[model samples]
Target: MRPTVLITGASTGLGLAIAKRLLETERYHLVLTARESSLERFAEAGLAPSEHVWLRPLDVTIPSEREEVIDEIEREGTGLDVLINNAGVSYRAVVEDVTEPHRLAQMDINFRSPMELARLALPGMRSRRRGRIINISSVGGMMAMPTMAVYSASKFALEGACEALWYEVRPWNIHVSLVEPGFINSDGFERVRWTELAHLALDRPSHPYHRHYHDMTDFIARVMHNARPTPESVARTVQRTIERRRPPLRVPGTPDAYLFDLMRRFLPRRLYHELLYRSLPHIRTWGPQAQPVMRMAPRAMR
Candidate 1:
């Protein structure tokens, strides 16, 4: 029998791409879960019954809902062979601009829920003495970003939890892997923008930190508009991770990701922070006419 693979957050983006790729192989049965909102859309995507695509309506952030999903899966299948925790949320808010609830919500969805799901899956997997857990982390987790403070915190927490759990679970023959994609094609940023813009207080009196608030939000929007790594690329990396006999603890999905990691390691902390700040649009503002003048500066000075 083909091994059953359960993937959370499979409504779209990297999760959907991974499901699509995995289905083509004919070697694994797939169980995909997302909120009810995505069901009709996914059904319209034309996935056939023979594809072995089982859809479960689940909100991973809710403990009861997640437990129900686990129960349903157990009733319908033999046992889970792999679990991919891909569901996540992002927000374009600096630390001071964000609310306490928003930060906790991100942590709930991105870190805690995934950990809980993994906890639920362990008993069965340990009994079978085999399993694979692939965590879809981000470069944001490894490095800080001006606007994505809360999102980074959640992902960073997830990375730490997964890394430590990797050691504990290896004895049970379960392989745990983290995939950190630099910038993948997803609705994450758009959602962030919509929420931030909707919640922003336009008429409120400006404060010392208000300039940063707008710049950071706008920068996040521009980044979302300008560059996005293909979901297929991340899907391929995930496939490789699952199939490889010896996968590393972390697989960064982009050259930029690896480059930044190297830079963080080799550069002094102050120098790295300065360079990073200069590189990010939020921290470096230039007038429309300023670019041409700046471009003419000496190569080193520029």
Candidate 2:
């Protein structure tokens, strides 16, 4: 029997790429879920629904919908061999500026939903004594950044949970792994929800960080343009993880991901902070402007 794999958020971006790569292997049956409209779009894009691939509508934040999907999987007798928790959303804003609702929304989709789905799928996997649970995390989970605090927090939560679960399920022959990718060129950026507070602040020049907001956004755009990895690369990482009998608990989705992880592990706290800050075009340029004021201060002040 072909291994059955279920991937959430499979209509576009990395999820879609993973589905395509896995289908090409012709080694596993795929169960893909997305919003209804995205399912239509996927079909229109030539990945039309078929027997080997099961397409279903899913709003991961909804418990009832998740239950329905799990029930269907059981009814079909396609006991899941792999569960890819790829469904996630981002909310970009400073920690202080992020509203309660936006923070909760990020946690709900990125952390809570995946955990719930994993819980539902574990029983079957335990019974079979073999399975894979791949959690799609981000480098932000390892190292948080400005304007990404809330988003990173959710991924961090996921990493911690998955890591603990890995130990607990090892005896059952169930493997849990985290796929951490750096910036990826995908529809994810377009889907990001900027907090209302951040938006309002950007509209007002008098706001303390108004200039910084535009500067950061522009700097991020440049970085993404120059370094963003392809979704296919991430998909390939996922495929490899599934094939390996004893894969590492954490895997980098791209070469740059490996570099970033190394830096985080080896660099000194102060030096790392300085290097990270200077890497931003806005911060580097702004530093020189502040030097003159510092030089002009009274000798006692200096």
Candidate 3:
């Protein structure tokens, strides 16, 4: 029997690309899921149905929907061999500007939902004594940045949990991997939510951090555009991780991701902080500017 793999948030970006890539392999039966609107968008993109690919509408944040989907999988006796938790959301704002609702929403989708899904899938995987779990994380998980506290916190929590789970499940031959990607050309940014206070603050010229916020946003856009790492690249990494007998615990999904991971691991805290601040246009200007000084010849020589 062909192995069965289920991917959440499979309507667009990395998740969608992963589903397509796995389908091409013809090694596993693919299950792709997204919200109803996302599913419609996927269909509109001309992804026709096939015997091997099953598309389902799923809102990962909803508990009932999650349980129903898992129940269906169990009833079908497909016995999931791989579970890819890729559904997530992000927002940019300082803690003072973030709303309670927005913070919780990020937590629900990025951290809680994925954990819950894993809880449901664990029993079957443990029974089978073999499986793969891949969590789509972010470089932010390793290195937190301004205006990304909530998003980074969610991912950090996920990374910690998955890392521990990795060791726990290894005896059963279950491999857990975290795929951390830097800025990729994806719909994730387009879908980013701005807290109400952040939105209002950004619009106000009197706001202390308004200009900094604008510059940061622009910088991120430029970086993502220039780097241009496609979702296919991430999917390829995920595919390989799933195929390997003893896959790496963490996989960097892009070149930038690899670099950042290295810096996080080996760079001195002070030096790393300096480099990171210098890279951000907004933060770089926060310090005193160096005045140019022309040196005259020594008085005796002159």
RMSD of each: 6.6, 7.0, 9.3
Candidate 1 Cα RMSD (Å) = 6.6
Q: How accurate is candidate 3 locally (lDDT)?
A: 0.82
Candidate 1 Cα lDDT to native: 0.76
Report the lDDT of model 2 for residue 98. Answer: 86
Task: List, residue by residue over 9-100, the lDDT tens digit for candidate 3.
Answer: 98888888998898888888887889877888667656667777778878999888888888877788578889999998888887788778
Expressed as tens digits, the lDDT of each residue in 31-125 for candidate 2 is 99997667886776468677888889988988988988888887785788899999998776777788889989999999999999999999999
The sequence of per-residue lDDT tens digits that candidate 1 reaches over residues 155-200 is 9999999999899989989999999988654455555531243244
Query: Which candidate ranks first by lDDT, i.e. highest?
Result: 2
Q: Estimate each model's TM-score.
A: 0.86, 0.91, 0.92
In candidate 1 the C-alpha lDDT for residue 209 amounts to: 42
> Would you list the C-alpha lDDT of every candidate in the order shown?
0.76, 0.83, 0.82
Clashing pairs in 1: none
Off by over 4 Å in 1: 49-51, 185-187, 193-198, 201-210, 282-302
